[model samples]
Target: MLKRLLPVSLLVSLTALGLAQPGGLTQTLLPYTLQLNPEQFEQQGLALAQEAAQLAQFDQIELALPRAQLAVQLAPQSAKVWSLLGSLYLQKNDLDQGITALQKARLLDPKSASVLFALGSAYFQKAKYTQAVDYLQAGLKLKPNIPGALFDLGNAYYMQKRFQEAIAQYEKAIKQDANFWPAINNIGLIHYEQGEIDAAIRQWRTAISLDAKAAEPQLALAVALYTKGDREQGLALGEAALKLDSRYADLKFLKENLWGERLLKDTKRFIATPRIQASLVRTPQPLLPRTAP
Candidate 1:
């Protein structure tokens, strides 16, 4: 974790004492002069950056963005502020802007693993698998135990069809954080793509056991079961999965999650069932959040 900075609410205004008009009548006021020293500006920027991070934690990124943007302007040399701006942009789905800010942060602090990880995520969002892999691997080398960065590295490898390496990274992530269900769920994805349905099902089952509310594994398990002739259970689970998050109902979204063709074909059929379709219609889904790497 990084050091915390609180928001600043400081202004130094020149004193307006008794200056009278030519008629000796008291003037309402004199023009105010405000100025901030270098340290003051830096503190203000750190303050705004802190506010942005707090808002992002609450998923209030739309309101956090401008503060982060101004933070960077006020403290352009501060790697942390630039990184915060980049993360805010990423949350807003602004990959190019995020990448730019992350790149600047990297230049400011080349050894920052978090900034490198952020750059990797931005590149991944832009579909630049090689760049994503480079950045993620670099970040992992700097901070080896970051499970999220390891999972992100695995995703980059998966995108490049480097399945063995991807699974190795995923396995490493699971080792680092035993309850990291996303890594386990992703291993299932790779197994399914490699035609090992049983293995994939086991992995998804384990992931679901770890976090029953996770929609990805639930949906994957549903599709696999459906294709394996467990129609009733599959349909029921699929409906439940969609009710949890309807975006999984879209093939395009599945593809974005790195679902390969074989699993996708099965998922297409699973979601096409009248039951899942009806569930999607009445799911009451809200806006999509930033998906995990």
Candidate 2:
């Protein structure tokens, strides 16, 4: 499973101490500050970080890395800037560099919930589950109800196969934000792996209720159902997932695995069918078991 990284919100709440008043701004001004207000400069730095993040999402890694580095340069002490740069590095699979950036951000603001979460996530990505747990626990201490911290802490535990601990963290995350679908979906995956099909299905259904567009829950439900001998229904859901995300490599592999001979023989036939395509659309009915088997 690809480790889920916490989303970094770039809303930096700058303290009054960080702001330079009009007269006081002059002495602290850098060469690049000739025409910009202190606030405007900070805002620009944040905007650049956001832009870099969007580019990174599109897999324009080369463009994102340099743009984010420039944003960090523009706001050297900004935790948001360093966090954004750290995320970009993680996306590029440079765990060591990512950890360094996140550590720097944490040093700048030791109690920042976002920075601590990012640090924990970097450690998790590097397979340092113990360090990830520590950072996440510290973050939760500072911001006891932070949903992301709880969610990532659950992820760290899950990676270590500590199912009970992972579920506890995910439950805490859901308690903080009942609409947190990722945690719900993750719980479903854990249940499925433990052979508790009914519980897994329930969690997945709850996740879909919270966020119908989340493909993970749907895919997980499909897998559990197929493994439990509901092959046809499972195949339908798997096909629906592919329709929703035609480029999702995992869905394609799952389809092939579930319907080995059929997938091999009727690839074009399957793709051209309307029923297959319509399955991706949001349906009015909920996926539940029939009363009479």
Candidate 3:
């Protein structure tokens, strides 16, 4: 037998007793317009933000970014959501959008050191060293032990040709994390530019010891050795470094990574060698974007 349908009154009573909306109060939640409170929105937003972060860790920024964008709309006051969106945009090389989103994040959470540092990095990408320095220094004041941020600050100073300050920041980064080899490697860059070839060699050696596979220090050290008349050793090392990462053969890539004029000249000669040229031809790996030094 067909059962009789419930009346609107009965449905309304059911909704009033905590089912769903028929046609009543705000708490009587509608189908598509289900009203979630501020806390509910924040909770959902943070969940999406966390998923985005996990995806980003897997180098899936394209998939992560849309979720983060929606999270920001839900949690407009969340510094973390805005910051994540900004960072993903930075990864995509959308610098203007990155800066704008980061600025919004900074406004939401004035004391967030990560947002400050990310903003600094965005400015660095835009070649605004002075602003980068300002924001990086501010972030460092709040969180002094972050080795990557310190390294970035060092790069900022290096870009401005403030060599000593750059080294100071790199040293601080090394102090915070002894195995932070990029800082050591960049210190080598400074020494090399200052005409202290031997000092540069030692720093690069130490950097290599810390991370044997780091191509930048390997190539830099190779250039140094080749320039210093250790032709055979330089050629061999340069070949090996090129095999490890052939993008170093591209002078423009090296320049973007903050390799200075002197080192670039030596690297040009080193890369033009027959052996390194052959290694470049053999390397099948595509170059990935490494925007930061």
Candidate 4:
């Protein structure tokens, strides 16, 4: 029966696929009489490289940097090692060295999304938002579904006060994965700024549903509600936010506003001095008269 022969066929396929090679391909390719001893130097080098990676993951920058440097020297062509060294340099705030190591990794693996993402992050940290945008955009063009690139692009635009563009990018990111909480919260803030109070509340509530412990959305919702006249409920929400993060200074200001304490007054005193209303709007420069013949 076909069922009875299925297991046998799979077993033969696996054997040919090298899964059954006991000593691996090199050993199988060479005769036992000609087999040499294991390369101790290569083994020691790999062991040291692994040790460096482990230390880097644990934040031991002082030891990690030197060990990773040694690993790169031992394995000059290793993309993984270079990437790790770049990350370690980034953690140490050595932007130039971090960029150099990451560039080397990119040279080794030009299409690596992770390396591109890391490089983009380094540029962003250096406040090179324009450069960050270009690199992140390139990475996204290559890998359209990369959420980090989408998020960072939105952040860059938001920092520039290009809210509409930021919203569009965030919306795209959310469409890729609706449960991306940060994008959801960002949308809520954008709506709030545009004076769409109800829509802002809805967006923030949706974000809270997606991530109940997200403090920013919760705080933003509280502020929106208080500003919209539900003082008691808003104050309670603000208090809850403060309990979640006691260091929130803005919440204290909100608390004072909700409780009717005059914290600060509008400083611009308006005086109604009557005057003739004149159209001072600059008239378009008159087209120069045609040159006379």
Best by lDDT: 3
What are the clash counts of all predictions, listed in order? 0, 0, 0, 0
Per residue, candidate 4 scores C-alpha lDDT tens digits across 1-293 of 11121133333433453423334435565322212223432343455568878887786789878767766654667787888889889888799999999999999998877788788878877878787777778788789887767887886676556888888888888989889877877776667666677987898899989987765567677766766777667656655654554323233443322211211110000001111011111112224321110
* CA deviation > 4 Å runs, candidate 3: 1-34, 287-293
What digit string (tens of lDDT, one per residue) describes model 1 on residues 18-81? Answer: 1111221235343333344667557877888899899999999998998787778668899999
Clashing pairs in 3: none
Ranking by TM-score: 3, 1, 4, 2
Per-residue lDDT of candidate 3, residues 79-165 (tens digit):
999999999999888999999999999999999999999999999989999999999999989998999999999999999999999
In model 3, what is the error at residue 130, expressed in angstroms?
Answer: 0.6
Question: What's the best-to-worst order under lDDT?
Answer: 3, 1, 2, 4
Off by over 4 Å in 4: 1-49, 55-63, 247-293
lDDT of each: 0.84, 0.69, 0.87, 0.63
In TM-score terms, candidate 4 sits at 0.64
lDDT of 2 by residue, 1-293 (tens): 32222111221212222422334334664321233355665676787788998998888988989768767855777987898898889877799999899888888988888778778877876779999999888888888888888888988888778989999999998998999988887787677667677998899889988876765566566656666777688668767655554433233543322223322233334434466457545443434311110
Provide the TM-score for each candidate, comma-separated.
Answer: 0.84, 0.63, 0.86, 0.64
